[model samples]
Target: MISATELPSTRPYLIRALYDWCSENGFTPYVAVKVDASVQVPREYVQGGEIVLNVSMDATSSLKLGNDFIEFKARFGGKPRDIMVPIQRVMAIYARENGQGMAFPVNDDEVSSTPLTAVQPEPVQSLPEDDPTPTSPSPSRPALKRIK
Candidate 1:
């Protein structure tokens, strides 16, 4: 029984909306509140580095439910725990740079509150004019043939 007023954040409405969505869809919405540095990088997470997430819930719903928050937990190679996230406690709800992050913005009905804009870092490009030397040398061969 979390209060909308007690939740210290400007984005309380957004979090509430997410919670409702999760409840309706048989899931739990846990945003990143804190990160653990001593965790190991699982074999599956080799491509993408592991990120510790502090999932918030009204109760120990995540552990009791089990199925919810699987995607986030597995991606970071960690087991879900009972955590409470105040609206103001959330620093970032990041998934990844590969078009896989979650952002919540203030909305009218809370439906449009989730941050749809994924901040994917642009791919790096190489310069074409890096090589100063030409592929083929000029036809001016010095002393090609010396017939004595």
Candidate 2:
């Protein structure tokens, strides 16, 4: 018999499912990623040590949402750049329009967020105007908040 620890994590699967949901519902899919050395993205666009990516079909090309990594080519500031993010590094996946999504546990040395049942709303800074990768509009983005 296999131990529970040996079981595969549902993170990647959930990520793919949410992506599909957003795509089918005409919602723009965005992923909040915790940046570190392992994450490959434009450093200039990162804010508060995190970056939100627009993974919608219209935003990315050659996008591959894999079990271990999400690979894609996107344009930032009119320059094409290759973006890669580890599955575990994704802190949250939510729709840019409705602000509904899931938050995942991030095991980071500098910062950490506990797993939650659903996303909570909070004010977050907007992304740079010139940067192609952007967070949700209206200064509002899904946030991970502890509910007691």
Candidate 3:
């Protein structure tokens, strides 16, 4: 049995929340995923081992955002395709219009060390309180501003 302290990653829940937020605000939600053998996406559309998908209602059909994976039927090049993406493979989920979203870190070493089947889901935890104000801006990346 998994201990309570060994909680499941909040990535999936965050993704779902952001997706809902985008949809509610009439913004398009996009997910950036790292493609691997486990990901069922169009190889041709995947660029540099990564693919960004629009998870909006019109783009996807019968989209099931599960705890471990997101499964949906989408049209690619005018052909219907079933897409499956592991929550672990999801790097980021954001709105296309304002670039407001969250990014999850990817540890290449951990990916190589662990097997996908060994992964398990636990209960979700609450996020800690943090100031929304931006302190300093890094030159490499743009600063994130909270949207109303």
Candidate 4:
């Protein structure tokens, strides 16, 4: 089992890679479970929604998680459960011969190519063309008072 701390400081890219693979290969594998349940998310991510996975390779029927632990089950060939795997324990993903599997390897030097940025975009300003003309505010007239 590889703790997140044991992995490189970079976010484990396995999740993103799996998402892309499923999309391209017509597999409906989804994150199914988020690492941070406390993180605020749009209603769509939780309401009537099961992460909308790309389930082409194997059909995941259920997911479970515990303290520092995560697990899931997948179905195949019309069977209720064809595979049982853990999230953190998964290293390499393999879907072959109508089945899905995971590998656990201990390597911490793999570089995640995603870039982190600290600079934010500046607000845009609309400037008037240099016509060198000044505009004045409109003036109102005073009401006439009756002299007694």
Query: Clashes per prediction?
Result: 2, 0, 0, 8
Quantify all predictions' global Cα lDDT against the true fold.
0.34, 0.82, 0.78, 0.35
On residues 10-30, what C-alpha lDDT tens digit does candidate 3 reach at each position? Answer: 777889999999999999998
- Angstrom error of the Cα, residue 17, model 1: value is 0.7
What TM-score, over all chains together, does every model reach?
A: 0.28, 0.75, 0.73, 0.27
* Cα-lDDT of candidate 2: 0.82
Model 3 bad stretches (over 4 Å): 1-5, 111-148
TM-score of 1: 0.28
For 61-135, candidate 1 gives per-residue lDDT tens digits of 333212111222232334643332223323334322222234533122222223323223334444469766545
Residues 1-148 of candidate 2: C-alpha lDDT, one tens digit per residue: 9755566678889999999999999999899998988899999998888899999999999999987789999999999999999887888888988888898767665332322222334557767789888655542343553221
Residue 126 local lDDT, model 2: 69
Candidate order by decreasing TM-score: 2, 3, 1, 4
Provide C-alpha RMSD values for all models, in order.
Answer: 20.3, 12.6, 8.2, 23.7
